[model samples]
Target chain A: MSVDLDLIHRYRRSTLTRDELVKVELELQRSPAWRSALNDTVDAHRLGATWAAVEGSLDAPTPSRLERAATRLGAPQHLTRIMGATPNLRRAWMVSAVVLLLFGLAVSNGERETATIALFLSIAPLVPVFGVGLVYGPGADPAHEMATVTPMGGLRLVVLRTLMALLTSLVVVGIAAVLVEERSILIAAWLLPAVALSAATLAVSSFVPIRNAAAGVAAGWLTLVVIWARIADDGVAAFRLPGQLVAAVALAVSVAVIAARRDAFSRAVSTT
Target chain B: MRTEADDRALLARVSRGDRAAFDELYRAHAGWLTARLERRCGDPDLVDLAVQDTFVAVWKSAKKFRSQGDVGAWLWGIAIRRLIDQMRKRRPTPVEANVLFDQVASAEDELFVGGLHGELGESLRSLDPDLARVLVATAVDGLTTREAGQLLGIPQGTVKTRLLRARREARDELARLEGDSR
Candidate 1:
């Protein structure tokens, strides 16, 4: 149980043989008395400095469970980190999406009224459109300027964050569609316009702030729905074949614009 | 009594994301780990960051603790490597060891550098601090020569030459000390 002074000297001075070195290493781990003995030798100020360092770091928070799950499920660390940091993936965003879906379902309930159904479907697509817009715009990221200098900051960040928001919104919408039973068909009709508008929002974002682009796309979409209904005398007319074709065309054109101007995705339109 | 088995059990809980166990493990080793790291690094701020980095890595990958040995050794293994990484990042200008020692010398290192190791310590006390550091890392800490190079922020070849010179000089110093005693 007695401490070996010469052995400790040789160990610290690196004068010990390899076998002797390994023995002391094991001895330190296995022997509490040795550790205590070593501790006893350290002056209080030096040990206090060590304790201060440890205590300071104890407050650095661990990763959240969702982030750990993302890593466990095989998302690369960089992608998971980006997704976790994205402002649009906040719990508030998901809660708002859920609220929108619930409100949509409640308003159109049992009435099967064409006007109410059109209102619900039209608003459904805007949920993801708003989310995609928030992925990489000025005012969307507090670190937007700092982020631009990072390798992952611009278009790559936008695309990854957009997929996250869009998929989460789809899940919320999908759940609502199943709950409405017969109205599920009307809910399904929201798919084409949802993608088209989300794409159009990002495409337009290449030239303007995301907030301005999202606001314009949402306003334009609602105005188009009102005009089409007035001309056709039916609010539900936009979910018809010609309307779906328009959504399809919009999707195709927005994608082409996005590809051609992809560099614009990395910086805020105003800054760029 | 806290035994090796207790460390393993704590590590088992740590692997399952138990925060309490993690905190317990950190408390058990952080002081000692910090003390040891300070010997190799002159900057306390960098040492603090290295300690934090070590535990953070352990938090993420406690499940990878497959060695049947003491958790203490394993923790030191991770910590020393992390210290090297932190040092590389900051690359603080090297100050003379004696100056660093005088400025920050805690009572314990006073014991280590002057009082504790006796005559063998006297021999190494004469060796160049840089060469002495390579010996401590590779020999006492069980790091490979390449790892000692990384830990000391020197080229591997430099570490090799320094290590050889250190061992030869330490031997000569011991012989001189013995001759003086006679």
Candidate 2:
């Protein structure tokens, strides 16, 4: 347990080669008793002056828990930061998404008919659809005008925010559905349609302003569901196999259109 | 725990305002830096203040570290001077002369006091305490005349006079040792 005073002296003078320094550090790590002896040979502490000098610098703000979790899940820090800034994560959108699902669950209570649940599922996606279209849609970010000027490409920034909004909406909706009722079978029915409609909104934004695209897609979905339900004399008609087929087709079309026009989403504030 | 980065990488990150990196560097070096400071200055509180000031200085000026020297030595240089500054500002309780001599007897500072065997150790041990301190502060600790004065709370003129006498005494003792050997 002898301390290497000679080596320590050389170390204090910073005379050790990098290789030698690394070796000593590795050795220090492997042996606690040796580490303690070295500390005995080296350390002491002070309080007030450090408090004065550091002055809260060490208390720098940490990333939000969600952002940190995302990073730990292997997302890069820069991407996580962009995701955290999505406008749709605000309390209003989060609360609305949860509340809308709850409202639908309450309406579907004990009823034997599948009508109300289908109608509710169709409408529940409205919030998320809005979120996806607007989170990255021109006016969502105040700095949208400077979109072209940023080091990050507008499309990449848009995709990250859109993903943030989409993921958050789907998660809250799914949780609310599971927690409130055993209607998961019925609730699962709307899952694909919700994603499809959201993608359609992104795709449509390429041809028109973000606000117009968002409003148009929302209005179009609502009109189709309402008319189809009325014609069938059943609120559940719009969410049946036929409706799911239409939603799937729309989703595929949206993907194709977005892929085709992907190069120009940069000016999506004015044109999709 | 994950394998730690070396001091250079840690310091580079610290200089970039990386708090986590600064934290890692602090954990690695603070213990010994504090121990070394505590040994030189007996006041726990003063030693604590010196250590704090040393790190705060490090955090602010980590970028000044050119790749020229080892991080540990550069840190010690900052720490020792910080302790001296604390000592200058507030006169701490003194280590009893016996306590000071005991450290030498214990061979604790193997590089400095332990090296003082035979003629030098005895000569210093027998010399007047004031003369011995001034001599060690200048010659052993390598402080300048003004720095030794500040550390000992003595005037520079007094430190010079005592250093002169201490040197003559040690020289004479060394000469005697040589004569005896012959």
Candidate 3:
């Protein structure tokens, strides 16, 4: 099909009716030769061939977070440290919690053999959580390209990270159970707070911004658990109310951020 | 033929561990890739990272090309993919940090300025988010109208309407610029 370049030029120079604009746009859209030229440009770029050695290509404006991230002395290194330390720290926390639990259990049950067996059985699920979170942090969003052009990748990344973190928390709690073998009553002690914190941490990621949220949630949860551990008889029960509230908000925020920014997420994934 | 040629020509050279070829490939494609990615990212540094990453990926995976399709498309496919990954990894920063392309002294500077430009580029810059995207997908990036619709999560007709709007804007801008020059 012949493209009337003159008509296109005319259309540009004068006010065309909406229908006329549409027709010219359609013509531009249908111009195979034009497309072939674009394709050739894409091809030439791929081939490491150019019409000439072009200097600078500006493309887009720079975003600040990236600037901050790149300029930060130890961001990637810090992220790497988190990768290395998380599992180890989690393991340490699990071991310490378990030791505490077992010591309490022994004190309460007076070295009863059956208590040891019960304690071992209770804390088994905690191991996996320790491993998963260490391996994948709460913010570990992996790369996927084609799917990034859609919203699916963002949703998938967030959901996957959430699951990993939750699993990590649960695993840590199980190990805590083992440590508190004798004080199985303490397992009865702050089990609710532990569970609540895990969910709340995941939920908080949505509202407080990306990098800071997980640490904030974890810090806040630990502080609360400690405060409750010190102050009350039924700390587990006390946690249920606040935990549920945070969890509800967290879930809402996660959903809203994902929904409101679906396009943004898609754009992110596409442009990455 | 495209794939075979690509494999024998570019991929083979890259796979042979030629950094020069990779660099050459990067230089050839970086301008256009930067331009397209800038449209989506609205950030220059991120676009630079994306461009750098596309080359890194090409260095690592060029051997995988197998030369079955257009290498430009393949490279673009890589650049576009990497840009999206960067975007997903971060929150959408409001897109205002344009490169100082207006300060550019020559076409060489324009070529390197990256991101979109010209009448289509200006029109795209002026459009609302949805309308702007449809124009980029169809006119600049060369996606089909249906494909543009799918990418933007809009209906096909909406894509058409938006494209029309973008074109009209471009026409007016082009006329205004021309009149000013005269």
lDDT of 3 by residue, B7-87 (tens): 347567877887666555554456555544543555666666777777767766777885556566676667766665675
The candidate that wins on TM-score is 1
- Candidate 2, residues A133-235: lDDT per residue as tens digits? 6566555665566654576655666666666777778888777656644454666777777888778877877777766777898899888888997899877
- How do the candidates rank by TM-score, highest first? 1, 2, 3
Measured against the true structure, the TM-scores of the candidates, in listed sequence, are 0.55, 0.50, 0.32
> What is the per-residue lDDT of model 3 for residues A1-272, given as tens digits with 9 covering 90 to 100?
55445544444333333223334344334343322322333334433332222212212233345334534755454333222233234446546555655664555465454434333433332233233333333333233343344433454544554454555556555655555434445344344433434444434433444334445655555465446545764434333456446545655665665566544433342231
Off by over 4 Å in 3: A1-272, B1-9, B12-21, B31-50, B56-66, B80-157, B161-182
Query: Which residues of candidate 2, in runs, are more than 4 Å off?
Result: A1-61, A107-112, A142-148, A179-184, A270-272, B1-182
Q: Give candidate 1's TM-score.
A: 0.55
In order, the first chain's TM-score in every candidate is 0.77, 0.71, 0.37
| Better TM-score candidate (1, 3) | 1
Worst 10 residues of 1 chain A by lDDT: A17-26
RMSD of each: 12.3, 18.1, 19.0
Question: In CAPRI terms, where does candidate 2 land?
Answer: incorrect
